[model samples]
Target: MNHKRSLVRRTAAVAAAGAAALVLAACGGNGDSSAGHDGHTSKSPSASASASQGQHNAADVAFAKGMIPHHRQAVEMADLAPSRAESAEVKKLAEDIKKAQDPEIKTLSGWLTSWGEEVPTEGAMDHSAHGADGGMMTPEEMDQLKNSSGKAFDTAFMEMMIKHHEGAVAMAKTEQADGAYAPAKKMAGAIITSQTAEITQMNKLLGKN
Candidate 1:
């Protein structure tokens, strides 16, 4: 009887916690720190988060190298939505993605700076462009997306972004497996968690989730 009663209590506690989480999401109390230096998230780091904290292997550097373009595409997509999306939810979500990620891109730049790694001149020199799922777009593809109209734009965005996110998840998985630093590993886990949710959100918006 004691064991049964304890199990019941634990179950009730879990259910209550889940309900509280739902309430928070519904209230738009979404909070994350370590997002771009905006109050939108609880913790956004600075652009100067230099990468030279210590020595790292080629794998960790490669992860950062590849992820930069992956993130850049995400920011580009988010930036495009203000003019493209008709749905308020989509627009709001896009704004949030840009605000959160723009600073993160800089944080990664800081890491590259500290590590004596060369940041890409623009969004080109994409590591993902070669292999990582062809995880990035060509300039022509980007142009096509830019000129796409209405629901056409929405459809393409969801399809391309879902694929894009999968590539980031792959990179994060690699980072977790091989990174020499704690911060890199932690950020990789965070990317996996955050992008998984955002991809789901995008799918739901497209009525595919």
Candidate 2:
């Protein structure tokens, strides 16, 4: 009878050990699953951040590089208005142009810097050569603007600015269609809207509408 009891006790002990092992295995599996879930959650935010920073294409790069010099020329033209314009309306329009474009130039530069692209220097690119692309004023045309004052300056400013805004609209449209970067595309859309309105206003001022 004592031998029989001893055998039963040994059997119970083995069963208990087996049960404990099974519990431990289950706990280990759950722990690994939890760790995997946490790792996946952590990676999701990283992916989102990378997406928000945006991915640039060739068109996006071109838009930023080209717009910088184009904006610089517009700012230059607007700068002359304060000193040379005869009409209060013309002076205000120039101020508005400067206010709108200066920040845009900085934004474009920042995009270039972030993309590992070269930022164009102010007044470095010949505006005249860019006339086919950005409706840039030739050196002579700018010289004429600089030399004029009063009513003549206002009329010239209105006409030239209208053309310049039209060019910007064209570039912005191209960017909107072809650029890959989200921020750049958004900026391009804004340029199209604002510049189109400005073009209409300038035409009215020029008595062309």
Q: Pick the candidate with the highest lDDT.
A: 2
Question: Which candidate gets the maximum TM-score versus the true structure?
Answer: 2
lDDT of 2 by residue, 31-73 (tens): 8798787788999886886777767899998888888888898
Across 46-73, the per-residue lDDT of candidate 1 in tens digits comes to 3223343445677778877777767887
Stretch of 10 with least lDDT, candidate 1 = 41-50
Clashes of each: 4, 0
Backbone clashes, candidate 1: 4
For model 2, give the RMSD to the true fold: 10.1
